[model samples]
Target chain A: MLVRFWGTRGSIPKAMRAEVVRSKVIAALVAADGRRFDSETAVARFVDEELEMPVAGTYGGATSCVEVDGGEGDFLVCDMGSGFREFGIDAARRMAEGHSKTFNIFMSHMHWDHIMGFPFFGPSFDPEVKIRFFGGHDDLEEALRRQQEEISFPVPFEWLKANIEFNKVVPGETVEVGGYQVSTVKQYHSHDSYGYRFEAGGKSLVYSTDSEHKDDDPESEDMFVEFFRDADLVIFDTMYSLLDAWTIKQDWGHSSNVVAVDLCSRAGAHRVAMFHHEPIHDDADIHRVHTETIRYEELIGRNSRLEVLCAYDGMEVAL
Target chain B: MELKQETRERALIVAPNGVIDHDSAPAFEEQLHKVLKSADDGALSLIIDMKDIEYMSTVGLRVLMRVSKRAREASVDIKVAGMNACMCEIFKISRFDKVMQVFDTVDAALAG
Candidate 1:
């Protein structure tokens, strides 16, 4: 499995906000256990060694694109943000070089930040590539269609040459696409949003992109506990500060790292990728968030054998 | 885990108002099956007062789905009402929603 992050900024994209310039915070990643980079010195070394150009979060960037392929391999990327444009180029180059045929793009919601990168996704331009898009909204087709609405697009949805399969499933319904077992639960957002749990090649990965965790309520807590149960990896939407989550952005659809780290440990997830970085946050803020998140996670009692990580553009994890 | 049958006309409304777990699942299933059989006199409907049931399990689903299947086969009506969200997800998972017509009130079930 190869998980890569092309973008990490949350809310809307900001370019000049110092946070955007020094954007060393990586709230997204690609997952494949090619190697482990856990220590700060190790990460610094990798950023200095592996990446030709160290990329960080930029406003109007992509969230995360994970390409998992082994037994029943998959090219499923979550959120079609600006980062997806780069991933799309990668996939397109792979396709040009004869990489894979079918690609499944799963969207957490149709929010602008999550959808802005679609027009730039290069695979959609390829005649031979197929894109299977999945999401939970009242009308999945309309959401996809609206993306190509001519008010903004030069071509219509019908004019697309590439086959884009839209799968709209009800909550609790499980769908097996190719060899991947995709289980979904309606997550907490103001309107309808979906959180996906993917099980493939004996590995379980849960993507909770945009969710709000109000652990004060027992029902909400139980619902989360039930949804996560036991899992290996969790990509969570930790887009707000604890102060913002509890105060300013009270009902906004995102979690704080406190909620993210705590929920990951509680749900027995082995690792967590803290994603959907707030646009105002820079690299130092990320380090601080990590410290604060670990503090809150410790307050929940230390039974959790969990790994927490920050993501940035072009970061990859092999598991 | 006791058999508490409350009769409504010829219809037998088995109101097993508690959490149906392993400790109580068999008794609940058996007793409900009996009530369903006795209500086979072609009553208009067989109602399960799920109003008081705080929780229902996969084992409990065995009872509901069986009764629903039998009632459908016998040409007698079977319906459940007043389920909370927790129990509703159980039905949604088993896809019991499409098979059984659920309502919020007994009158609505009887009327349907």
Candidate 2:
């Protein structure tokens, strides 16, 4: 199984400002110390070895779309955020190269950010392609259709040429979809989001975003730990700090990196990716949060071997 | 977890020792709530002295937060003081420093 992050930003899409890019360039040049690279390989090596991730590359601006390739058959997509547009283009190219045209998409919720890319999905206009949407909400079709209403978008849902279908997934029931056993769990959110767990070929990956973990809710935490138990990779929403999540941002439908690490460590998951980064955070701020999360994991990971990863746009993990 | 309770300057001081983690959080919560209950009866303020606390996990922090919320509801002024370097870092990284009123010392918390 392979997992790819097309977008990792939360709340909304946040493009990197020109000044931020200029600062990164200045920082990189300062680190280079006026030394000239003989080859592209040398420059790559310098970027890899000398500069940190924030100074080298961006975490990106796209919001919450992850592609989980099961290595054969139909492609499974987690969300349809703005990043889905890029994923759709690449997927269309793959289909043109004779790849599968069937798409099995798992919708976390109908939040605008999670479904905003549907209008731009290139394959949606293709008559030969088949798209299946699976979600815990019964209003999945209605939500999609409403988003494509004439007042909202120029394109109407009925005008789409693709053969689209929607299936409501019952929570706690594992259903086979796209050559994998997929299960959904109800999450705490304003409109009630659902987290999906996928298992195939003895590998497990849990996609859990836009969910809030209450500071004092032990029962809910235990349920989440069970949902994340012994997974190879858990993509989690680390969109807020503990202070914000507990104080001003309570009930905002997001979790913190500290909670992610704690839950993943408790569940004995091998690796946890911090996904759905706070939109207000710059690349440097995200890097700092990731660094702090790693340190927190070390502090709390007594007898637990959990690897912490910060999910960036275009990151791929294979299991 | 063992909590030492005392009253000083019309404020109730509850000092917790050792690690406040998953195993000890319930006890800490119970003792802290009891202190909050007592403070609501008479004390003008409540101070959690963490000078002897070696570590605090997420659960422990949650317990503190719940207690703080209860204190606020009860109209009792609650403050935290005397965290070690590691605890301070934990608060800083978790952003709990902004959530709660933290002081360098018990005297500072009392004075401020």
- Global CA lDDT computed for model 1: 0.68
Once fitted onto the true fold, the runs of candidate 1 whose alpha carbons sit more than 4 angstroms away are A16-61, A64-66, A69-72, A299-301, B1-112
Model 1: how far residue A6 lies from native, Å: 2.6
List runs of model 2 lying over 4 Å from the truth: B107-112
What is the per-residue lDDT of model 2 for residues A8-96, given as tens digits with 9 covering 90 to 100? 88879999888989999999999999999999999999999999999999899999899998777998999999999999999999999
Going through the candidates in order, their DockQ values are: 0.01, 0.82
Q: Residue A113, candidate 1: how far off, in angstroms?
A: 1.1
Chain A TM-score values, per prediction? 0.82, 0.99
Q: Per model, how many backbone clashes are there?
A: 20, 0
lDDT of 1 by residue, A252-276 (tens): 8778775676567668887788888
lDDT by residue for model 2 (B1-112), tens:
7799889898899999999888899999999998899999995699999999998999999998899999999999999999898899899999888768999999999899
